[model samples]
Target: MDEVLFRGSRKLEIMQVQAQLVASKTKEVFATYSQATKALISQAIHSNQVEQLKQNIAQLIGYVLEVTRDFKYQVTNILEPRRLWIFFSTVLGGKWSRREVGIACISFVIGGAVGLGVGLIIRRRETIYRYMEAIQISHYLGPEGATVVEDAHAPYECGQHDVLVEVKASSVQIIDAQICCGYGRTFRRILRRIYKQSSSDLPVILGRDCTGVITDLGKSVKRLEIGDEVWVTVPFWSQGTLCQTVLVSEARVARKPKNVGFEGACSIPYAGSLALSALTEANIDFSNAKDKRFLIQDGCTPVGCVLIQLLNNWRARVTTTCYKRALPVAKALGATDIITIDDSHYVRDVHEKDPQEIREGDQKLLLKELEVRGETFDVIVLTRNDCVDLSGFCTKNGRILCTAPEELLSDSCGFFSRLLLTGYVKLKIVIQNTLGLPSDTFDEAHLCHATLDRLTEMVEDGVLQTVVEKVYHPKDIEVALNHVQSPHSIGSTVVTFR
Candidate 1:
């Protein structure tokens, strides 16, 4: 009876050992499975459909690593000799359970097969998912060249799709007024609130003034395709224009200019539009300007210089203000009258007489008195400076055009009073180029490319010339800006990109 009791105790111990062995083997199998899962996911990440693998497999690595660490400690501390003796007794005598090993093996095989099937099903679902890689341009605000805010992904207009354009070189106008006048902070606050309100499924891209070839195109797109060279304009708020690749509207594009390379063409989509608008307002008839008078205040500005030549070829009397530095070129461009405005009335009286004179004996003073006595001209155009008293300078019933950033008569009490009380003038805006107009609306017209091909012919024949002074590379934009802002700048400054 004592021997039987000892055998029974030994058998019970063997059964405990078998249970521990099964637990250890199960942990080893799980560790192997976890490693296989990691290897499979790593392979998938390297494929082209990497973006489609949105499953947080990296997170799984952390969880599995923790489980593996705990299991390893348990397995290392296992009492193996005692476990073996207990297993021997249980297998040989107690349950007659060698047949059950096949059952356990089959269960593990089925579980592994099921896991693989589910993994394959998940991978198949991911295969069809697509995502956008966007480029964004934002202000370099932080020390690491970060922005306070950036335009991530904005949704497409539902079924409305758009053509994506990637830029090579671009510049965004930063009105310092917006940043300095509290408007920027207020705007940023509003943007943060809006961002909080937004959902996270939005797409994101970044880019700035840049040019690049189209590397890919969506099935819905038609106007452009892969391998097309395009120019992209980035707005102040980064939306993908600064990105390595950007999307643009098909309508916003023109065929890349034949003469200018991609580097030069990139700027024209934005600044060229500004230049075109200014010239359009000058209203020089390409066919008939050869006999009219058109005056430019600072004839050397990009817009002003372009307008000068456009007016010159139109046969309009081209009058521009030039000091000693710019006089020679201004005259060479056919400036009918080049007035070097000074305190002396001597130079101005030589052609139009001293129109700005304050004394009766002075021509300017006399002109002022004549204007008061009801005198005017067919057209009066003002381009620079706010010192000109536009309300007081007009002739009765004459057309006036001005480009001073100051508020109009309605915003000034004295100026408003004159316009309201004096009933002599009937004002009509022939054309005013404000920020509202599209940039390219007047390019072909100003260049007279189609409307008056004769003007293009004249330009080609050296009868007309565009006044370009200096060209700077993209990196030297600050240098170009300095020259443009210089009081002594003579002609138009162009920053060429390579």
Candidate 2:
């Protein structure tokens, strides 16, 4: 059992396996409660077998403890401010080999004596509640913009509307990577320190989505309770989910359905809520959805996929466009029809196929193609901001929505001047950027709990699913981000803290 467990762990580390692959290892299924009774009956006649099983489990736990302890702390003297400062410098300076060598020497001499005396004494009394006090982070040194501190300052406090959670899994998202690599880094640094209305302090961690068990509840949190397993999209800059524990708002929290594993739950909250908000704001008539024709320009995008499923559940006649590789997924997600795009010469193909039909200068050629085919959609969702003349296909009274910014669509000199012309051409076009004008931007989390409740029912009813393509450790966050950021990504990449 010891050898097998280590082999499995090593294989997982090498393969970067997803949650489903790990779940497949447990094949013994018991369909009824009587199975437990039968197992107990067998145990009555098999005391030796039960004892052997107990021994195996104990040995496995011991091995796991040693392995986890070794990796959990590189420098355990976290309380000593001076050593922490030097240790952090070495980490940021790329002197990890030297840091490990120093750790080995110190751990051998000072830790050796202490390990023999206090290790056994402490291990017997330790609990998961105590784990909350550690406030561990894999990276602590940074002039590079996002590395955080290691100490009890993390696993942050629960606020009036928050719930304290021991995060089982968190995920790397594109926005998170953008922030880490210094998208408005200096301005954010200044704002966080001096701004009166900012949410949290400087270096307030980074993970965006997570699944965990509620360890503590806030004063105003009525919807959740301690020990409830939930998923949350941690609101911006207050407290991140990268640590062992996180404090999330009740409004941003949702009960994770039994069908959703921790790894998969990490991916659902942020994208799901955003898509839900878009669809909700669209105000589609679900009772007559089949009569409502909708088109999603990029069906394989994260939010696009969720929208497809939601539209399907609403019985909408949904048409989607995607690369040839995504045909199967698009169909499985309930697209009524799919238009496959050839990446090699997408623009050229559209032009060559219809050079004389629509002679306007670089109009939304895609929409023109649909117009030539006499296909009009009531709702058209643009995943990318492009030079697309949506007026050609959108019904006059219907809606054309751009998920991206208007500035992205124009390449020529007259973009700003042409705004009125463009608006008049497609009178009902909606830019999501202005959805909640007069506010900073759309606050999707405001509708998070409501959206997730509906999504949870869909998941439990087997109508929707989470796509977790890869899983990683917190130490490999950059690698995980790269995977999800790639154009080939079909699903989300998650990071496990447990």
lDDT of 1 by residue, 240-307 (tens): 34333455544443344444455444433433333444445645356645655454555554335545
Query: Over the stretch 75-103, how does candidate 2's per-residue lDDT look in tens digits?
Result: 46665767876777677795556568678
Top-lDDT candidate index: 2
After superposition, the stretches of candidate 1 with alpha carbons farther than 4 Å from their true spots are: 1-247, 261-272, 275-290, 332-334, 341-387, 390-480, 490-498
348: Cα error in model 1, Å: 24
Best by TM-score: 2
Per-residue error (Å), model 1, residue 420: 30
Worst 10 residues of 1 by lDDT: 423-432
